[model samples]
Target: MSAPAVGKRQDRSGPGTSRLLAVHLRIADVLLRLVQLHALWLGWTLRGGLVLGVFPATAAVAAIARRDALGRTAEGSWGELRRDFARHWRGQFRHANALGWILAAAGALILIEERVMRAAGDGAIGVFVAGVLWMLGAGVAALGVLVWPLAAHFDARPLAVIRGAVVLLLGRPLAALAPLGAAAALAAAYYLVPGLIPAFGVAGPLWLVTAVLLRGGALPAAPAAAPEPR
Candidate 1:
């Protein structure tokens, strides 16, 4: 009889050892996902070539992460990651960047107002400016939390995504706010360890939003995939 092929090895370990190996692999998968997510986010943010591709790139990763979390998609290998990124980057590029620019412009306006309010200092006008600033800031934050998830799971115009996020936040304040708070905490962690952004920063926020929204029934059962980063 021919000898067993050298490359066709079979496991001879006991059942307990196989189970232990499975657990170790699961842990490694989780770690790898985090690292991949961070790298995706960091690469797009830094080297987003032409038309500010970071926005769509980040949104694509969020979509992939959501699918993986829900078991709709498999745990991604590097090739899978690349394919998903390319698919989403092409599909979502225009809409994602459009929304991003709009948000950036709004934020810039708010910052200018904030500076003006500080210059005015201590009066009725100051109080009004502060209040306006607070409202605007909160509005932006609320929108930020919902937009990317909407992009991942819906088929709609960019304006519709914005509108839907507003409606969802208003209708389900408690559910939305909890995840938002978690996202904030994760962001704080990233700030303290900026180095981790290239290996884990984006995963925490993406996972929190995707998992919470799915659990809370904030998202539809079937994802539509209309269009951005959260």
Candidate 2:
């Protein structure tokens, strides 16, 4: 009787241990992927000479995240992932840069305006202008958060992609806001644990945005192209 009881206990523990190990392995796999993604982003961004590299690197990340979100990607080897990311980065170089520099200019302009406002001192007009600029900055941030994923998932020109993102933001504010909140939380986490920045910083937020957009069905089935800027 005692032997039988011991065997039953061992049987239960064996499956429990296996299950725990599986969960741990899954977590480790996810962490490894995030690390790979971060490394690729950093490498490619540097490869592009930083200024030219950031947008395409980011676009590549967004494309990969979107595919992963849609269940179109597999957990392949590291070499495979790198090749895939490089392909995306190269493919998106022209269009991504076009979109990216425009947004970067807008953000820079906002910063310049803020600095001028500060130098002007806190007058009534300055306060009002600052408030308006703040709102504009927030709008631009929201548009940016939505833009890359839209660009990645849809087959449209840069201007059309921007228009699509704007439409999605206005139409699905909650879906758009969800990723922004997640991004803020990730930023806070990176601040507390600086080491995470190298591993999960960019990929983490981009993955969250992709997942939210996919799960929420915020994207269109087939987006119609908008006219190019005249």
Q: Write the per-residue lDDT of candidate 2 for residues 6-112, one digit (tens) a residue.
A: 99999999999999999999778667777888899999999999999999988988888877777667667889899888888888899989998888788889988
Which residue pairs clash within candidate 2?
none
Candidate 1: segments with Cα more than 4 A from true spot = 1-27, 45-47, 191-195, 223-230
Task: Report the lDDT tens digits of candidate 1 across residue range 135-167.
Answer: 998898778767887777786777788888888
Best by lDDT: 2
Among these predicted structures, which one has the highest TM-score? 2
User: lDDT per prediction?
Assistant: 0.74, 0.82
Note the clash tally of each candidate. 2, 0
On the 0 to 100 scale, the lDDT of residue 223 in model 1 is 65
